[model samples]
Target: MALKLRLKPCERVVINGCVVQNENRRYTLTISNFAQIIRGSDILQEEDAVTPVRRAYFLIQSMLLDPTIAANGSGAAAEMMAQLYTTFTRPDIQDRIARAMGHIGERDYYKALSALRPVMEYEGTLLSPAPSASAPSFQTEGLDLHAGHHAGG
Candidate 1:
């Protein structure tokens, strides 16, 4: 099967562990054969992987991006799965995590990431502060926002 990819100007994509970037124009990429492709825009930067799910995501993404990463990250994959289990206790969430892990076990990195997306969204909602009218906002009348900093440089 042929996979046709339409890319915008300055877009970047990693194909079979090599990075290819379009310069200053729109273009279409055709993969006539099987290939591992990850778009630059879809990539999650390592530093941005702050949450447990994101950390797991980064691990899987790295494995997909590079074979060396895949070789070195097996233990990390197990640890990340365990962490996900500990963090998300809901049966439904756990099921999704297991599904992704199953894909991981099959070395289907792309599918694993796809399966993990909802868990990531759930984690985002869990971590984000949702403000309500009746919810108590902390009183900062006498609080210092920069308590640890000194006036002098």
Candidate 2:
């Protein structure tokens, strides 16, 4: 099956380890073969990786975007994963982390990235300090702390 992508004007995407930028107009692309592809919006910069999970994600993203580092083995990725396992004692999160590692081992970078997203979410809840008892309950939606951006700010 082909993966079809409709990109906005000036949008960028990494396809099979190559960075491609759209020109003046919106464009559509059909990837007929297997390829590692990620949009610019989803690309997490290394400097933005603040938490342990985010750091692990950045390492995996780097492996996906740059084939050379992946070929050499991602020692940093393994180390980060180990640290995350030690830090987060939740069984479910640990299982997801293990699955992410399996995906990475199988060279399925996209799947690995997907698995890490939920792990990050769970980690956020665990690491966040509890609100005061008198304070009103608040929800954290569309809030990406690692991105250093607050929702509706």
Question: Taking the tens digit of each residue's C-alpha lDDT, what string does model 2 give over 1-153?
Answer: 998989999999999888999998989999999888888988888888898898888888888888997886567777777788777788989888888888888888878888899998887887899888798876779866567465676
Q: How many clashing pairs in candidate 2?
A: 0
Residues 65-111, model 1: lDDT tens digits: 89898888878897889778777889999998998889788888877
Worst 10 residues of 1 by lDDT: 144-153
Residue 53 miss distance in model 1 (angstroms): 0.3
Most accurate candidate by lDDT = 1
> Cα lDDT of model 1 overall?
0.88
Which pairs of residues clash in candidate 1, taking residues 3 or more apart in a chain or in different chains? none
lDDT of 2: 0.85
**Residue 126 miss distance in model 1 (angstroms):** 0.7
For model 1, give the RMSD to the true fold. 3.4
Q: Which ten residues in a row have the lowest lDDT in candidate 2?
A: 144-153
